[model samples]
Target: MSLVLAGTVAGLVLGDAWLWVAVEWSPPAYAGFYASGGFDTPTTVALLVAAPVKAALLWLILRAPAPGPLDRRARALRRLLYLAVAHALVLWYPIALLPDVVGAVFQLALWSAIDVLYLLVIRWRSRMLRAAAGVAFAVELAGTADEVLDELDLPELGSSEVAAAVLMLGGAAAIIITLVGQRRDGRWSRGTQAAGWLSVGVYALVIPFGVFFEGIPGGGPVLPVVMGVMALVGTVWLAATARELPVEDRPADPPPARRRVTRVAVAAVAMLPVIALIHPEQTPHLTHTGWSPACYDRPGFGDLKPAERDAAFLCRARSTDGGVPPMFPDGLSDQEVLAYGRVLCRAKDHDEQEAVLTRAGSARAAWGADPWDLVYVCPEIVGAAHPELLRSAAETEAANDAHIAEMNAECRDPWPRTKGVVQATARYFLFADGDHGYLVHDPGDESAEGEMDQAIDELYDDGDALVGAVGSTVLVGHVEDVTDLCLTVKAFRTAPPRRLAGWDQVTEVPVVSRSGRLTVPELDGGDAGAGAPMPNLAIAGKGRYRLRVHVRVGDAGEEHLVVVFPGASRKRLELKS
Candidate 1:
């Protein structure tokens, strides 16, 4: 009953471990197989079934007649097998539970060794079976070490490929030598015969697939599937042969439990070096949060492209000055960081944008939140540029109300007035950063304007229009990168809200702006000296209005909102009325 209870507990522990692996490490398609609730019914049922099955098998084996006194060689092999099983089982725990294929192959070999060794302990003499299992054990041990070295990104110990080749060649030679010279028991159980054939068959199948079809370290499912089949077959064979042990006279009284424990402890000490070699946690490119290619050796970003380098520069400056990344703890992926760089590069002042990012980062840190969480959701980083941090909520609100009133009267109002001064602001837009790039129409001809436009246009598809209209200047440049870029425009009353929407409106401009830029073609084809400016999106009422232009470049579309302010025109037109 004690042995039965121990088997039951072992079964439960193993089943729970398997369940944990399935839930946390399985591929997305397979995760759901065992990831239901706290009390997983399938896992529970499997564990319970295994408990009684294993318990019964143990009871039968214990009840069987004991073996006659072993010869010197047999006793040595028994001790060696015990050591191998103990050390290999520890290594196999994490490796078998890993969801990847490289692990599965190692796990199959370790499991096979354990099974064959256990059978030998019970005196099921099969020399051919022992030889095949021994060969598999050697190959898997070398293969697992090779794989672990590569996964850890450690310096190679010779070539893993060469090592695997030599190990496999030796195993093949051992199998041939055993088959020619060794012998099996005259009367083998059907299960034992089947298990032996299956073992050889699996060993033959794994080598070629692992070498030619699938490269070592990582790949498709051939090896994993073969290993899985091997495990299933080995388990079935173990169960079938559990009752086929040879009858023997009762042996001398069993050794004391304390003596047995001491022997086991001595074996473990002898195999410490073997156990120390299997370190899976040291594998590279993995972190507590998750695997991110973006996090790999990206310190200086020397490997990045030119634009990504600029992003890296900006990130470095921000971190140096503000003690935080503009993005976050891990930073953005290559393209995203570049896009953000383009946005910052286009700003009228680099110092201002850096200051804004710094303040934002500081605020996020104060709140114990990620910098990216603040930046992605923050509104202050929008438009030609963000303004100074509002000192007070009331002051922010008052400024917002005044700006809205001015915009409504000059840009949103519908009226005819005397020609007012046409102010021209040379705003620049960049598109190189993919989806994260924004269109800006600021008031100034900064030195970085052309560069910013070039980068932004790089993001545009060929034949796409580069529409820029600020104050009275509207010039459309064609996207020369590819021929699929085009423009779409719309009007709206309110700007789109960002992820963090509850921020004070007075501190930041709305995403939509009527006076920022224009993409609407002018009616009557009027040229504004240099080129055709987009038609003046003139508002004819004393209210707020927004013109949203959507530029479709390839599969993605970018939206630019310019809130048109008529300025003094609305008052002059009202006076005329």
Candidate 2:
């Protein structure tokens, strides 16, 4: 039993290491999804692997012999491990299958209570603590069968829910049996206690590996083979070492003073890293080379500034009016611009406060009413600013027109012009923001110009002009062109002709349009709820899209359109009266 526990702990630690290796070597391949947006395979795998590893290690250590004086300690450790495993498994399994956020919170709270009870029991043996632990474990077991039964979509019998329930219940039963057996024997060995402590160490080591490797890239395709190999090797190594280990015995009666001190020290050390990990003050470093000056104004932004000031530049600007102007014109040099911009942005100017930023340019461009920038800046503006202009209709038609034009001008064969054009548009949106910019080609291609790049030069000159006008940090030239491109070629729209029960039905509604334009006449029912057919649209542009629904729902509810896209998906817009 002691050897098994030790092996389990060792396996967990090794598994974690293997997981980390997997993440570093092989990332998941997600087709049709943006690289920036996808599931984290490594992290999931790590968490899954860590849980079992921890349980096994704890079980093995408790089975090991304890020094003469602290025989009860072995029993206490065993009980704690058993309770923890049961609580964690019950909560984790149900949450994974059903994924109810509120229910998960409740389960976490229950688990926390169990932990507290376990700690109290170890402090002083009371019938109440033992009862609490038993009740907690029992509740976990009872809930398991029902939760497993409810997961109808699960494939294979005795897998997923059944498998999970068996492991947890079996572990719990084993602990109870072991406790009864130990009481009959009247002797605890030091080997058993060592095995338990070793298990914890193994668990700690395995966690990082599992998180980094197995999960992120996923155990799909050929990765499972790698995982199996790692698990086997880890298990074998641990088993071999655990068998020959020696047990140390302590005095039959140790003063209570020393035991208390040791427990306190262990607890304090364990909490140090956890505290650091969750500290509210810790700020993550930003990896992106290009973040808008506006981001600097965000709280904790100063923590991320590069150490070498010379490597970066800051641009500062401010609008005299509370309203943001279309452009800022200040010809401050690049260095001066970055310094000032940083200050202004940090100030969080509402009206006349100076905006500051750090960048490679002299000043930042204020994004005006351009649809693309509006989508980037205050997305609500797209719907609020222009009532007559249908952004989706105009954008889609423009893209179609652009595609046709490009095909005629470049491809001439009409073979695969759309793909190339679409690719070009994607690239443009990906890298369009900030000072070091590229120009949109005739067919919507973005080519980085060398020292003599005409587009970059033009943008730089135009940006300088705008910065001179507006004092705000972060300025750009020719936002109108970008907005025009997004509206015309990249936006797709679909709307229901009549009220529907759900969004799924809306996808089936044919987007019937005359001259590629949709019109919604004021109809009965509140502006947002069951009324006239809405014009639903999807924008394929690389950046964000904003929808403006036009109508009034009175006090009941306003009509709105749900827009889903790549980043920042699913926004609901109320129809303006």
Worst 10 residues of 2 by lDDT: 466-475
TM-scores of the models, in the order given: 0.27, 0.25
lDDT of 1: 0.37
The residue ranges of model 1 lying beyond 4 angstroms of the native Cα positions read 1-36, 56-71, 87-141, 155-195, 198-577
Best by TM-score: 1
lDDT tens per residue, model 1, 1-577: 3654564465456654443333222333332333433335544554444445444433433333234465554454444443443333234455556755666455445545544544355432556666565665556455555555666676644465576567665544443333222224322243333444444444555554443334222333323433443443333333333333332332233457745664554455335435534446533211211132222333322234544434333343234234433333333333443344445444455465555445444333332322222232222443113332312345555675564344323321111131222222111223433332333332232422464455445334433334433333333343333211222222323343321222111111112223443333321222111111333333333323332232222233221223343233211111010
Q: Rate the local accuracy (lDDT) of all candidates.
A: 0.37, 0.32
**Best-fitting candidate, measured by lDDT?**
1
Stretches > 4 Å off in candidate 2:
1-127, 139-190, 194-269, 275-577
